[model samples]
Target: MEGYGPAEIEKLLPAFRAGEAGEAKPPTPEQDLLGGPATTPENYTLQLSQAQAASPVHQDATHAPPFLIMHGTGDTMVPETQSVALHSQLVHLGRQSTLILIEGFGHGFLNPGNVTELGPGVRLDNGRLEREPHTGFTAQQSPENPFELEGLAADHEMIKQFFNLHLG
Candidate 1:
């Protein structure tokens, strides 16, 4: 995660996760990949400024609506702790908010489960053709399956119930 740029990060995506590498590899400077070239104080300031500008300003908690926050524990782009921090802040301000953490998932949870073919063929968001991973189950190893869909579905349902209780 530390030694990844936008391009390198893109390659780790689902579409490229299984694709064969091309002959020509793009040149990525070591400094660019690591925390050397873009880790200047000015870069940090710019990032902070951008985040502040993009963040929503909180209103008075007394009039705010209930909130449901879902965070993926394996999210490398944005740490799951950020959601926890926000949830804690809302609770501290006497607002109704619930945060659900989905384990073993990265930023993309729209498609869940072990890697499998979609059908005859299909194209992914990143333009590579492939099937998404199966939802609610892990992959089998040594002719033995370790994935449990029922448990994952139950956890997903619990999150739904929590949202319904607070938001409905």
Candidate 2:
């Protein structure tokens, strides 16, 4: 209740208390090893609290080491703002930090078979993002527009350079 908002605490407190009292059902054999649905109030609160505890944004960053943060502008899984916030925090604390946003790419772009789809607000062409409020598309890699493939190679080189500069 202390860590959560009034509305969320109202919903979660009942379930959390029920779970503490052993009113929640144990996992059945048919259920996955990870347990029940993610939306379950007890599990949701636990997971959210754990994630918050582990989040770097909430940690003390004073005198932290240099950082090279990279994120995809089109990523759907993790918001790019997290990287921006971390970088800003590091810079504000007087630590060296660089933030790079890869345009027209989604989460796991370095991995194979991950399709990059632009949302309605933007469009992707030749690894570049274009402003097209009504247009959205899936990226296609060709000889002329080998965005993801070239991006992976470039990212590897950038990582190598960062390590050489920071750790060498």
Best by lDDT: 2
Give the TM-score (vs. native) of candidate 1. Answer: 0.43
Tens digits of lDDT, candidate 1, 33-109:
33322334555445444433433333344655555555555556545655665556566666665555545455534
Residues 1-168, model 2: lDDT tens digits: 000011111122223333343546443211222244344566757655654555576678796766666556666445566666666666667766666666645555444342444444333232222222122322222122212223333355555666776688
CA lDDT of each prediction against the hidden true structure: 0.40, 0.45
Off by over 4 Å in 1: 1-47, 56-62, 111-156, 166-168
TM-score of each: 0.43, 0.50
Please state the error at residue 7 of candidate 2 in Å. Answer: 24
- Point out the worst 10-residue segment of candidate 2 by lDDT: 1-10
Q: List candidate 2 stretches off by more than 4 Å.
A: 1-46, 112-154
